[model samples]
Target: MTVKPGSIHALLGGNGSGKSTLIRILAGVERADAGQIDIGGAQFAAHSFNAGLAQKNEVHVVHQHSSTFPHLSVAENLSLGRGYEASIGGRILWPTVRERARRVLARFGIGASPDQLLSSLRPAMQTMVAIARALQDQEGSATGLLILDEPTATLSSAEVARLADALRRYAAAGQTIIVVTHRLDEVLDLADHVTVLRDGKVAGDLPREEVTHETLVQLIAGNSLPVSENRGQRRLAGRVLLQASGLCVGPLANMDITLGAGEVVGIAGLVGSGRTSLLRALFGLSRVSAGTMLFDGAAYGPADPADAVRHGIAYVPEDRLAEGTFPGLSVVRNVSMANLDRYWKIARLRTKAENRDAAAVADLVGLRPRRTDLAINQLSGGNQQKVVIGRWLLRKPRLLLLDEPTQGVDVGARADIHRLVRGAVSEGASAVVVSSDFSELAELCDRVVVLNRGRVIADVTADELTSDNLQQLAHMRIAA
Candidate 1:
């Protein structure tokens, strides 16, 4: 198949459909055992980064989790590809450098100052900074190719619009843009051409205007998934497992909340809202400057994560690779991580017999066929997610914190995760889930609390929940 340049092309498919694999190959990070790359009408060697570099700085890729020094300032990050710091006879200056940084950021609608550290920004803000680098390098340069792999997975809809606009401008500026995303709506709006990959090869190809949503869904997912609406009403009056009064942090405040045993409260918000921070404050990752937390009818605000875990409060963070799964360890080890102290014998490692028992728990969580010997990376994406969730479920927390737990998961895996979460609650675990998906909040939550910017805007029960309602509440300007 022949591909063209300077067009907004998309690789559309479900989870494990080889979208990411293709991206890795194109980005010069993965070697395709057999195919050659042709950039700007010139065929390059099959497995060579030098060839990629030779093609006029051909490609730039942005991944799901960022790769940067977290402590570095935004200027430092943007300057990674485009130089801002100069030798200048061994002298350093700030204002002139940051002035250039601001000008570059405006090109992509990032709108952030240079002196701010990357650790201070949200994921979307960080992404904007990253995208600005591409723009910076492309100015008067020959960067003809760009690859985006799941770029909008963690972004809110509004941020997606901004990022999409930025990419569209880049394409209009005569660069080839290739996107890989499961978000069909984005594909419908932003793509000029679409390619569906099923197993390892192209399943179908269609021009953008020719592709309809239903037809695109048919190509990627084949058939729609079953929407399980069999959930019973939340009992609503079990013993209070967790209560937070006046929970105040950087962007979260006046968050008086109470969760009973078996209850699941979902906080829906946009990208910059304080849902994750709120969860962190409760889990002791973020400092709750002013709040009183109560667990099991007792006053409880732990000094740190260790104490929080000891008190049976678990958090599954938004950045799964960074905060959830241990990619370096075995499947048994990753799943049994949260409560490793349970299997330990006074500072010494557990015996092979105990390790095998951990593998049995892994099997219970549907990570079978490959056991303790298998590396955690060997499992498929869905199975990896199951292992991460199960690791915490095995801890039997009184309160679970789930932040965008289903972000990168496919529809089937999302349904399975929802089922698993509800199962955990049925077995008497309470949870607070933070999701950017309004549809998911309206579906799985017993009660929905919408946070806009930094404060609660609306609190609605499942009886009053709808996708439109949650979206409105999440986007509304609530009076401080």
Candidate 2:
């Protein structure tokens, strides 16, 4: 496939669709056994990093996570590839480095000063700094390439717009850009051409004018995804299973929440708006400074997570990698970790019984490639999440809490997760979910509680809750 010069091309696909492999090949991190790479119409062996280095001045790559040293200044990050400014006597030249950083910042129209620490910048600004550093080595090259992988995965819509604007400036400056992302709106908004991959091959390649969101989704999933379900139609029994009033926990102030039996309630808010904090509090991961809570008609103050779990409360944390599942354990082990008591007999572990139960729950949660012995880290993000959430499902928990349930999940896996959640609710489990994706809340929740600055500003029921409604409510609260 030939990419147009000076165009912004979006590479999109579901997880495990070889998008990352292709990128690795392009970035010279992997050697291709077959086929050759042609950069600017010049053919090179796709066997090693040497080929990539031959065109080093013309190609730059910025990954999803910033590689910049947080404690260092922007100037230091920019001077990493290029030599640092040093005197003949081997003294560092801060002025020269800062001046160089200022020139690159000016070229990119970034407002950050060279001496400013990278960690002090906003996420969007830090991303811009990374991009600026990538371009610094190529200085005045008009026919260069900039590749960004999932640049806005963690950013809000507003921050995404800022990053898009910076990328557009690079494209306008005659740099060919390739962005690898799963976000459809971003592809439509920023890409001149879109390429979809499926099963290690290109499925669809279309110009910006030819692709719509529906078409892109179809290409990615290879089928029609289910329409958003009418959450209001689901009957939620009004038996309150969990209640909190005057709840205050680590930046959350006087928050009130009510969760009925078999109901899925979503907490919607921007980053740093106490969404995750509230989930942590509900799951007993955080200490409540002052609050009143009742669980199953009894006082609910968990001394720790163990107390919460013993009381039939299960939590799926936002950072799946760090807090949700143990990566080194097998899928069966991870699934059964929460219910080991069931498989323990006096002095010995019932391994066969544990595996049987783990396999059963794995099937129920629709865990793909259902191998009990595979390491949890070997599974995709969605499968790992299923293992995490599925652990609680086996326990017949009275309450479940999920934070960013599908943050980095692909469309197919996300659908599977939603089906699992609905199945759990059908079995009468009460759940509280926290997510930044408004559409996810609108699709899954019976009610959405919008938070702004640690306070509940609106409790929108399913019938009244649309993506636009949630966005407007949250934005207006912030504006107010």
Candidate 3:
């Protein structure tokens, strides 16, 4: 789809759908083997990818993860390129640079204490810095073709609204904008034009008025996804293997829950509704301000990930690549990473016996029977995710925590993961699965706890789960 001047356009798709690839091609990060791109009526024949970057079209692309030098202060990162422009004499006046950095960061709702290191802030705050740095031009106008790839991923609704307003204002001031997102609701409201990419190709290009949420859904998934069955009762509340009493993290608060052995519990919430924080805290990634988590009738407080893993609480984070598996690492290593204690002693030396153990678990997860040296990166995206889950499967935890377990995985592999989840249950292990796709929760979980702004809105059974119910719990106000 051609982006007109001063238009707020959107590229929408699921993971590996070429949305990132297309954006990278446009940003000159990667080259397109075929097709020519026309920018603002300029037909740039693609000889080399860098040719587009050198054109100086005032283009800036912010990817999903915030790219900030963690050791550097937020103010310092924002003012990195600005220093060349803000310099007075041959030398950069440090005090003047600090003064200008605060002004630039303030525009993005960020306070500039120019010396604060990036590591001191949260991931979302770091993302705002990347956005601020992208807009560090004079009159805040460097984003002639500002491309925000999942900018609202880690943001709250209010923050996303602020960014949507900012995009509108940018478009108002004659700046072209493109937002690459998976959320269809945001596109209907914030985007002026929408282009759907399926299988590394453009499937549909339509104006905002011409596209409905249903239309976009059908286009993206090819057809409507099947509705999950409203099956069996909450018959098996056998024993509370994992207990959360007054679990309060950032947005989650004052919650009481129990997961029985041989059962699955699902957590449903909007992207910003504190679902991620709830799981992270359970896994000991985030701080748990108030509440106690009891594992097998014992108080559990994980000092770190090692503590969590050692205690048999394996968590698969939302960003699978970041939290789940090492891509470049071999499949053998991916599986063995979790169960290293079984092999390693006082030394970090890996054993061949442990390698055989890893291969056995991989085969169990339907990851083909192969040599122990197969690189996980060389496998398909779905298989890579399987390797992640397979690795955790080797843990054989009593309680499993899965957040968006199949986000980027394909349809078939999704079923495979569900089977593996059931396999865990058969082994007398319970699980608490966090997923935005409510149907998935219905299919794989025995019960679901719907959260809104960190509070448990409703605790529902699998029989009561549906898209409408999930939407009501996630979006509309639940009756107090």
Q: What's the alpha carbon RMSD for model 1?
A: 7.8
Best by TM-score: 3
Q: Kindly report which residue stretches of model 3 are placed more than 4 angstroms away from their true locations once superposed.
A: 1-38, 43-59, 74-128, 137-143, 156-169, 179-225, 228-235, 326-330, 345-352, 467-472, 477-480
Per-residue CA lDDT of model 3 for 1-480, tens digit only, reads 788888989998644568877777787778778677666555665546553452366668888766768998766787665553345557767677777777877665674477789888656566667877886773645345788888886666666776777677668877788888765667888988999887787889998779887777666656433556533234476777888899888777787778887788889876666787877887778888898899888998788878887778888877766767777777778788887777787786567867888778778878753555787777777787777777788778877888888887888888888888888887877888888676677677788888866688788864466545564455544332
Q: Give the candidate order by descending TM-score.
A: 3, 1, 2
TM-scores of the candidates are 0.64, 0.61, 0.74
Global lDDT of model 1: 0.74
The candidates, ranked best first by lDDT, are 2, 3, 1
RMSD of candidate 2 to true structure, Å: 7.8
- Between the candidate structures 1 and 2, which one is better when assessed by TM-score? 1
Candidate-wise lDDT, in order: 0.74, 0.81, 0.75
Question: For model 3, what is the error of residue 351's alpha carbon versus the real structure, in angstroms, after optimal superposition?
Answer: 2.1
lDDT of 3: 0.75
Between candidates 2 and 3, name the one with more favorable lDDT: 2
Clashes of each: 0, 0, 1
Model 2, range 1-480, lDDT digits (tens) per residue? 668988999998765678888877787777788787778877777775453464563677789866888898889988887778999998989899899889999988888999889889888888999888877766687666778888876676688899899888888888899999766667888999999997798999999899888777667656423337544355555788888999998557899988899889989865556788777877778988999999978998988888999998899998889888889999888987899888889999899988998889888878888887999999999899988988888998888888888878998888888887888888878888888677788888888999875789999984677765665555442432
- The candidate 2 region of ten consecutive residues with least summed lDDT is 223-232
